[model samples]
Target: MAMSVIRTKRGMVKPAKETPLTTLDLSVMDRLPVLRCNARTLHVFRHGPEATRVIREALSLALVPYYPLAGRLIESKPRCLQIECSGEGVWYVEASADCTLHSVNFFDDVQSIPYDDLLPDHIPENEHVDPLVQMQVTKFGCGGFVIGLMFCHSICDGLGAAQFLNAVGELARGLNKPTIEPAWHRDFFPPQEAEAEAQPNLKLLGPPPMPDYQLQHANIDMPMDQIKQLKSSFEQVTGQTCSAFEIVAAKFWSSRTRAIDLDPNTQLKLVFFANCRNLLNPPLPKGFYGNCFFPVTITASCEFLRDATIIEVVKVIQEAKGELPLEFGKYLKGECVSGGEDPFAPPLTYTTLFISEWGRLGFNHVDYRWGPPVHVVPIQGSSIIPVGIVGSLPLPNKGIRLMTWCVKEEHKLPFLDHMHGAMDQEPL
Candidate 1:
């Protein structure tokens, strides 16, 4: 099915209350070399043409506090990024798809839909002197529609992006104000040593390393009972409680390693973002609107991963996560402070894997008058590593849904089989 743009225009959504010009701070995580660009997300809703109007009007209000999104990024000295809050506004577009929502199997896998057509046209870099946030509202023939958001990663992370969308949804419901007002103190962390030069020029994660091969994607659903069983099993083996994400990551890494057939002694890296919102001595103000997570890594040999039980691997991951410096101030003192070493950088190697969690961010709760979105899908730029873990929102049965991209198409089936096998193992 084809998608045709009904109207395309630029919107300047200034703050509902006029505020003076401001320069916002950019987090070291925001300056990660690989993430210095736009990220896309698609939200599916069952609504009509009127939904577009609601979103347009609501977005204008949402931009009031998130003015930086309406602004542009300036590449200044020191090679760091800064937002110029000039109120240029975000890109807005309205389009229609010839096919009905039912005709597209969006829930099964993200690849089932036409992401390029559903998302707003990515403006050429040379012509991107306008805004940081761009959106497209598409109405399907079945009266159901999809909202595509293209956000500048330099301005916000997944949580920050969700905060913005939730604000828009609140306004659409005729609320006078957003539940949480945004806080944009980029200078939250003091300046520290510049570590950009001290770090190795290793590949930052996000882009596909092998352009020649197609990565396969799949979603594995684990019900709450299964999750509890898995966690219980882990605790019995390790004598420590494990979060759902940790347990799942352990299983996933093991399966991925076996599927890829790396050398038994080869060293493999696992990295994931650890939220630092409440880790600081003086915690960041509530509702801080920016990137506040850093990557933490744990290494294991392929043979170890292949032979270790899920509980044993979970212990290693849990210990690595527990050992992370809890002081938010220390994060500011690290290489990130100087935009040097982004500890959160995705591992750049054929043997590395990244796992991320999003179940708690509440993406499924974005209610834009038409009701909450039926499905929320994240779409990263082409520069991202294709093989990684994506923990999604919980299913209705309180089970978790996990989506993953196996680096090579040939490895996908084996990976999926191994993963399911791990999850389905009965408690011993």
Candidate 2:
């Protein structure tokens, strides 16, 4: 497949002109205090003869109604209405003829580029406190192209963003407009009441970690068949079907614990996110925005880790999903605020691993005016060893592609070796 670049009119906004920072805008920021933490880069390419015409056609269709695809944040009214932006928030770039698209190469990193380089050099110091969602497009002499994107974590989670990009790709391919228009009705889903009921049994009860703990990524690249086989073997061994995430997480947690030689009797925990938008009595609408999500935690003692089977860990994780509720979201918000002052709250056990599954959703669809991306990868953030997984299965003849990045200091060979071993095993 040949990648094409398209040039379209830039999406409109306030043009950084009048009313730079309106009162309503400031208020909107106050509600969404959590800054964007996720950043990603994407690269696209083409091989064989240059297919400029085909690529151009793809780009033109990709840019129509470009306003919704690329734009900046604009002012919005107070708690009365949802926050809104004026233009599309997406951008694009074209590749030179010298580059060629290879049928074998595709990735999530091809779509994400750091926004810091695209921003103005000077901004109020306060503005720096909150991250800006930005992207850049670059063309390689070899006819390859790259698109980059930055997102504020407060606005959308990985699943939500993947949904947005998929919609953009659908638009490029002349699919129907996005299934759900973006919604920012923050008031509709405000923080939960402080006095909400608590599920004591479901609460996380693990040992506290040292202060100032940091997060790291464990990068492991393997074939897609291997991952699928790993999942299948895990299920066969444990007799419990698990998502790619659960499988990789269980392996990491197990291997890391064993590597550290932690006490065999100490309790261990696995904390993962659970979207709460639909869990409410009156489920949140497509646009009903706010942090309407909470973490689902699974706890097992060190003895369990040292002696339990992978299936047992997976079964415990499956059971933990049952405790998620709308109230948990509120509790989480309160805890975030409370922990801001107290250093004693469990430090998320520096050992906790955060796995984000993006490839399963076909995120390469964010074409804009350019053709499909070749690679996409997330940038580093705070204390979480974030592992982003992307790429198609059944090995596209080119094979499955996996991209991961973790702190170089944390030795991840054991976990990688385990993954390799699991992949080699036949599916149960």
Best by lDDT: 1
Candidate whose TM-score is highest: 1
Please give, for residues 1-428, the per-residue lDDT of candidate 2 as tens digits. 24333332222121212221212121222233333244454434332223333333333343333222233443343332222333322333222322333332433333232234322222246532222344344444555544455555555556556655555455545665555565544443333532221223234455554445343344455555656776777666767677766655565556555544557767665655566668765676764423555556556776777565566666677677765653354454444322232211223444454444556544555554445554444455544443434343322333444444422244456546654554454123
State the lDDT at 158 in candidate 2: 60
Find the number of clashing residue pairs for candidate 1: 11
Which 10-residue window in model 2 sums to the lowest lDDT? 11-20
Candidate 1 lDDT, 1-428, residue by residue in tens: 33444544544455565555766657666766656778777888866558777888898888876777777787675657778777777788777777777776543456656777777775667654567887888887778788888888888888888888899999989998889988876665555543442244433445445545556677888787888988887677667788988878888898889888888999988888888877765777877868787677788999999888887888898878876764234556543422233465544656767777877676778888878777778764443264454555433346777767655777888888888987897233
TM-score for candidate 2, residues paired by index: 0.64
List ranges where model 1 is wrong by over 4 Å.
Answer: 1-17, 122-128, 192-212, 236-239, 326-331, 335-342, 383-386, 393-398, 426-428
The positional error of residue 378 in candidate 1, measured at the CA in angstroms, is 1.5
Assess every candidate by TM-score: 0.88, 0.64
Cα displacement (Å) at residue 365, model 1: 1.2
lDDT of 1 at 83: 80
Residue 27 in model 2: lDDT: 20
Q: What is the C-alpha RMSD of each candidate to the true structure, in Å?
A: 3.7, 7.6
